[model samples]
Target: MMISLSRACVLTAACTVVLTACGGSTGTGGSATPTSSVDVGKASAVTPLDSATIARAEKQGSVLLYTNADAEQMAPVTKAFEAKYSAIDVRVLNMTDPQTFQRYATETATGVRTADVVMATDAVGMLNFVSKGNVLDYSDPNLKNLPDYARLAPGVVAMSEDPVVAVYNTALIPKDKQPKDLKSLAELSKSIKGKVGTTDITNPMSFGSVSNYTAKHGDAGWKNLEVLGQNSGVESGNGNLMQKLAQGQYQAAYFVAGSVRALIEGEEAAKVLNYTYLTDGTPMLPRAVAVTKKASSPDAAKVFVNFLLSAEGQEAACAGGFTPYRDGVECAYGLPAVEAVVGADNMMLGGYLEGIVKNKPEIVTRWKSAYDR
Candidate 1:
């Protein structure tokens, strides 16, 4: 099961293929020796659908969606889809990225193929499934409406760029005292120690962050990961981690998805938590979604995916607190527009997967060893 977020209103809301040797053992979990560097490929493009797609989708009666996004993050999209179709039922399954991936894999392996769509914050994992032929090759005419970075292979698409940012208790850390970057935050976390929380690196998105950080900053990034791991407690899900943060169990959390919804809930609870992107460069992780290869309702799946990438859907996402992959749609909550914060070249999606998702067993094992110690 996916970990459920406890707080409310928080609306809110990779890549490719190269490897090389770096100076130090790099994979956060593998061997102590320096790891190799990697270059990733961009998402492949799928042929766009004709105008008849939606008409066909209405005949399916329903579409089953499996997603890693919590119920709150998905409510608006589901509501919008159902509202627009008004006829087809959209049944959603909310679970952790790992759980969602595993369920689809298990079902596909057994030929059960229950889910029509799969969505998650783990871009690399979704892409891996795509490579394995688990996700369907889908095209939407709306694809032209999105930035090139949003499409991850012919059938896969990125829905939003939710930054992995710092979340601090405003009441505890004054504005002036807030750390400006991950390194500075690491220094501050040493004082708080167990009071700092973050998702485990084994989660593909976090793992990708580590790999991308190392690729970007080399030894410095690896050192930062060690310092971060040494100073913080590991948590399993964003909702639970943020809940603890709101209650002041942790003074701050590094790498929580900085969605507008989360920030709003902090205010609703009378907590003073605030989120900010890192100064150097924050991991603007994209939540990639696609129709499953075994989709029993392929037509409905395509319609839903297109809706997610459409102007109306993108606007709804922004209103609901998600950073849309579409540019110039306006940002939610007082956050700067995503285009102003990061560029396509800076995304972790296309280039860092070689070390993160491709070598998962070794990377995760190494992460567990380092984390456990």
Candidate 2:
């Protein structure tokens, strides 16, 4: 079972993954070395893990991760990490992006033992975090292996590349009528009107997705959104929108997170709901992860962060339903799939905090006016 922690119940539950016994002279468990060479796929080389660092991390024994990722989605990766490093206990605290930031801030202010690591999808918030010197400046060796965009800041890195997509109830919208791109979605909106749904731009992720596309297509992009806004209802999160879509409350939802496909429950809902990456542009939100300067177990946190960027870790994340962005690690919802449908040029990378922060008010106002909400 997935273990979920919150501010109110920190460290109350533990779901440790103990797949094998600790071995090796270094006392770091598992067959794979931190620097073990493997087929890097698109990457040129794998970063070697320092044996001394691993030993230090083992001594630290525990690492606490505060993230916006759903507990269920993170369980497999956490389990895999623990199975490899049996001595290190991994604890995940799940919260909203806002909550994660606020809670960490409060804890930091109070000089309390806070999260060893943090992960969130809000680019602006993360940029602020980095600017405030909240993140540790420990650059992992794996940083060199990832794409340039993956390195968001000195310490922060992209944990996953999740695409925002259009999801529809198949029973309500015929295959012929379903949208293939934002333009089609805009056209379909006229027929569906309020029956069409979209994310609330107030949310950072939602704003990032909409703004990213609009930034790329200029007037044409805004035109598409203007049409969508006039016709669509709004939800705060993709999961809620998906639930409504599956229930037939909304015939379709645009800019829904493709990752929500894993959270869909019930056979009936699964049969009715289907998603597609918009052909015009698919906004890829790279969830960022960073270690904190105040981490109680800094060494362990470094180990965990390095593992996340490793090939084995990417594979484990894929198993947990995240869209892996690393080369050669294929998932139906991965970067390659989106690229295949929309073309590489159309994959819009969202969450540039600096730009978003500057233009958010105007964007939100324009979005509200377009949607009349």
Candidate 3:
């Protein structure tokens, strides 16, 4: 879901226009209006069968995917799926997390053509969709092979386990002073002061990562984050934060997406930028995927979800630079790589949608006070 600052603004504007045209509320206070007036309990369900599902899906002929993931990152997966299915055409629409939910809600509510499947990093947002009965609940058999955390919610499954990490300019922060954990990062922040940067906690993904870290260590974690907030400048996207770090505007950044390394450019920027998973407890944010309850191509959606969880699909995901959690799937920045540095126990899973949504206001207040911005 990494996007440049300019692209983010454009997407935000585009979403507002679409929502307005579809008569959908632009508010983020709660779930978008449900598409159907019928009780969610009585909603129709689809049970996938091997040949039957494929036969039906081929007839549907297409699956529209609305995702927060950049098209480049999802290109390989889509290509592989199309190659395998041959009959089903895959169309990906990239949007910000909030926009993904908003537009889907709007289009579906209006009975217009909309996404068959949705994927995003915001657990809280995904859960909101599930709560509103906008998500289809289909148990993919592949779930058995994944970790328990991969089952993000009743209807949602993780597409990847992306680690929240600390990235520093190697030339600026010496190896001896390189932070291995959050507490150490806070300790180092004093020396660097305003040169340290972090993600804006107002964003759901950032909030989830920070809150999960705090949950793992309790009061001590909050205290460390407070110190971090006090000393760091807040940025909106990991891409922007990493850009600033590389440009020497910030000496370091904590609670950053590990995938940011791929965005770094040039020999100078490449040589200076280095990232590490937090050892005390690195937050693994799940990139969640789910089929829509009112999906136009339910059969094709099932086929696509199954493919995404298969071995070949995991390989495609890894090729697109997403971290694959399936065992024996080798990705340079996969869960295993994070585990090697932080240990399995210290890899904090982050999909506490209820808790995060419940205390968002108070948490945001405390976070703002600490940063005083």
Candidate 2 lDDT trough over 10 residues, lowest sum: 26-35
Full-model lDDT for every candidate: 0.63, 0.73, 0.73
Question: How many clashes (backbone atoms < 3 Å, residues ≥3 apart in a chain or on different chains) does model 3 have?
Answer: 0
Worst 10 residues of 3 by lDDT: 26-35
Each model's TM-score, in the order given? 0.80, 0.86, 0.84
Candidate 3: which stretches are off by over 4 Å?
A: 5-49, 264-268, 350-354
Q: Which segments of model 2 are wrong by more than 4 Å?
A: 1-44, 264-267, 350-354
Candidate 3 residue lDDT tens string, 322-351: 777776665666666666566779988645
Evaluate residue 160 in candidate 3 and report its C-alpha lDDT on the 0 to 100 scale: 84
Q: How many collisions per candidate?
A: 26, 0, 0
Estimate the lDDT of model 1: 0.63
Q: What's the TM for model 2?
A: 0.86
Kindly list the per-residue Cα lDDT of model 1 for residues 335-358, writing each as its tens digit.
233323344454444422444556
What is the full ranking by TM-score, best candidate first?
A: 2, 3, 1
